[model samples]
Target chain A: MNKRELIRRTAIEIIAEEGYYNTKVQIIAEQAEIAVGTVYNYFSNKEEILNYIFKVEFDKRLDILKRLKVEAISFKEKLNLFLEEHFQELETNPATTSVLVQESQLPRKHSLKAVDDFINELPELLAEMIESAKKKKEIRDVNSSLIANAIFYTIRGMASKVVLNEHYNFDQTKEELMNLLWCGIKN
Target chain B: MNKRELIRRTAIEIIAEEGYYNTKVQIIAEQAEIAVGTVYNYFSNKEEILNYIFKVEFDKRLDILKRLKVEAISFKEKLNLFLEEHFQELETNPATTSVLVQESQLPRKHSLKAVDDFINELPELLAEMIESAKKKKEIRDVNSSLIANAIFYTIRGMASKVVLNEHYNFDQTKEELMNLLWCGIKN
Candidate 1:
């Protein structure tokens, strides 16, 4: 891997192992097998590294969601694919999931606005999905942004549960959850 | 107020205003008009103050929930009443909610095990509600603990959205969400 990429990956590993407060720049540099100055060359400070990690993870998740495709066009199929893809990614990367879920508990001394800005872009992306689903008569006609926010929170809630409830096996219930999302909790 | 009560209340006010890290023991003592050492007499340190505040808020919420009389009622009514109680408390004490939510994110340099323990008790309380709902034929006969976890997350997600989303109105969606929970998403 490139030097910059090595630094970033090492930062995530250290943060995961020792947490943000305990993991210093020097520690990360040593762990990454680079000079401390070299680490500072790429990133200004520790907070920046944390923010970069967060953005990368967030962007990666969104990219996965964006790349979700359906060869045969059915709204149900599309939605199921989306759910499966999202959950599978989360299940495989529990460390990333842990960080994402717990990151909010981190101090607000840094640029949360950047994260907020990234999240703001989601409603529009969801608007397109909602418009298509509406045309397909898959979901009820509602305010796209509102529905989008609900959908986002629902998935977020599910992820939070997976992280917090250690013994809660998500695999068995994954299909049921996707089905519930499509058909809803209605009888 | 007594010296201890004054310090505790002032701590909440300061922490709420300036956040935990910014709000120090000296500042809290100044706000409470108590001696700095007097604050120590009441609590060991800043961490103790936080634990005290959490215990106070935790008991307050549980007290409200405990007052809910569910005997001889249909499961639907029981569940509705539980949610109504929760909403009413959360709406009334916005400051406490902020503290409670943010406190969970604070660095665990102190004994925060109490907080997790409190959360651990939720499944038991929720499982009882779920069983009652099942007996009343109000919800699907799924695993009570699983359903409880889902309900817990659903409320937390909705609550977070209410806090973060400026355009989203919880009041308007409250009824619809309740209906969704009661009736599921099926047509």
Candidate 2:
């Protein structure tokens, strides 16, 4: 891996292992087998490291929705694809998931803004999906933003549970949750 | 009001103005027009003050739900009452709502535990509602805990939105959300 990639991966590991507070710059440098000065060359500081990790993960998940085949798809299929892709990632990357869940807990100012920006984009997408579904007369005429938020929150909340619940199989929960959302939205 | 009540109210105002951290015990005591030591007799610490506020608000909302005639009501009515009550509280008490939202963001053990406990009860309560609805044959057979969670997350997500979009009339949105949930669960 390149210097920047190494720094980023190592940073995720440290933060995952020790959390935000205990993961220090010097420690990250040692873990990554790079000098503290080399760490500074690639990124500004710990916050920047965190911001980059969040953006990378956020973009990766957001792309799943954006790149899906939107034309001639059932709403059930659309939702299934959304939840499965999102939850699978959480299962694979528990560290990143934990960070996303707890990152907002910090007293930082920008985390909410970042999360809000992520949330704001969902409604327009849902509106498009709803418009198409309405043309098919598949569901009731409803406020798309509200529907979008409902779906978003359902998955988000379930994702949190998946992260925290060690004994529960999220795959099963995801299937059940997808069924509920589909049953709720479909005509 | 008594000193204890005064401190609780003052703490709410202070938290509303300066956020959870910025609003200190000293500031609350000052606003309550009492000595800082006097505040101690009423609250063991800031966290205790917050817990008290949460229990009071949560129980008050629960009491409202308990008193409603859900037993004799239609499933739609039962769900509508549940959604509207939550939306109305989110509108009326944005300050407490704000604190609760922020608390969910905290990485501290206590904050995480408190949020978990708050959400844990919801699934059981919702499961009860869903069970009743199913026996009435108001909806299809589904996993009550799973469906209840889906419904709960939807409401929680919308409530968070109400807090963020202060001027947005959540009543209409809430109506739409309830309708969606109702549609999803119905035969």
Candidate 3:
């Protein structure tokens, strides 16, 4: 892995274990086998490193959501596809998923703009999908903005357990979440 | 109100405005117009003051859930009743509601047992409700424990908006959350 990727991977492991507040830049550098100054060259501060992780994750999801938006699929298909992509990542990258769940609320409290923007922007993208599906008369006329946010909340809450539970079957969770969210939009 | 009640209310207001970490015991006592010694007489420290607020709120919901448990209502009816009681309190006590939504995640990091217990136990109580309903065939057969946690997450996420939106129509929010959670448990 490259130096920047190494720093991020090490940071995720430490943050997942000790939490964001308990983590330090020096520790991340030592674990990454790099000089502390090299860590600074990549990230201005500890908060920025966390923000970078969020940005990287957010961009990936944004790309996925954008591609799904014009796939000519039904709303239900879109939801299932989106959730599968999301939960699969939680299974493969459990450490990063743990960081996302544990530190997500911190953005609301601590002004972590990348995390905040990711959480906020995601629902808007989902809302647009809901709105388009309603226009196509493929779904019920529930409040798009509200239901999108609720669906996002469900994903985060269930994903928390997926990370924390060693034997979690994420496919089951994805189905349950999809069923509940589909109810909000289905006629 | 009693001295403890006074401190609780005053702390909620300051914590809501400046956040829990930013607010101090002296600020709460000064705002309450009580001597610092008088404040300490009732609560041991700032952390305890917040815990006391959480305990009071948790007990209220616990009573509501317990009462609903024995009532001969359908699962849907029980959910409506519980949600009405919970959301109505948010309308009347947005400050405390704000504190609950904002500081709730702190317990996982900090040692605030009341808040932790409140969040943890509510799901178990709801899970019991779900299990009972499933046996009677009043609700769909699903993972009761997982769905219960998802329901609580919906309430907290929607309630966060209820506190932040000064002109929020909580009745609508309550209904939206109800519909989504009902979707989870309903056949």
DockQ of each: 0.32, 0.58, 0.46
Question: Which candidate's DockQ is highest?
Answer: 2
Worst window of 10 by summed lDDT in candidate 2 chain A = A104-113
Q: Candidate 2 residues A1-187, lDDT tens each?
A: 9988898888888888888888899999999999999999978888878777777777776777776536467766776887888888888987788887766456454454446567777555766776677677776677666677777787777777667666457788887787677767776
The TM-score measured for candidate 2 stands at 0.89
Q: What is the C-alpha RMSD of each candidate to the true structure, in Å?
A: 3.6, 2.7, 2.2
Q: Report how closely model 2 matches the true complex, as a DockQ value.
A: 0.58
Candidate that scores best on TM-score: 3
Q: Please, what are the lDDT tens digits per residue for candidate 3 over residues A4-59?
A: 99999999999988888889998999998999999999888998998888888888
Q: How well is candidate 3 docked (DockQ)?
A: 0.46
Q: Retained native contacts per candidate, as fractions?
A: 0.28, 0.67, 0.33
By descending lDDT, how would the candidates be arranged? 3, 2, 1
Minimal lDDT window, size 10, model 3 chain B: B102-111
Which residue ranges in model 3 land beyond 4 Å of their true spot?
A104-109, A166-168, B104-108, B166-168
lDDT of each: 0.67, 0.75, 0.83
**Candidate 1: which pairs clash?**
A184-B185, A185-B184, A185-B185, A186-B184, A186-B185
Put down candidate 1 lDDT per residue, B1-187, tens digits, no spaces: 7887788788877787787878889999888887899999989888888888777766765664455535676666655776676666667776666666665457754436557655666655777777767676666656666655555656665665666667666664555456545544222
lDDT agreement of model 3 with the native: 0.83
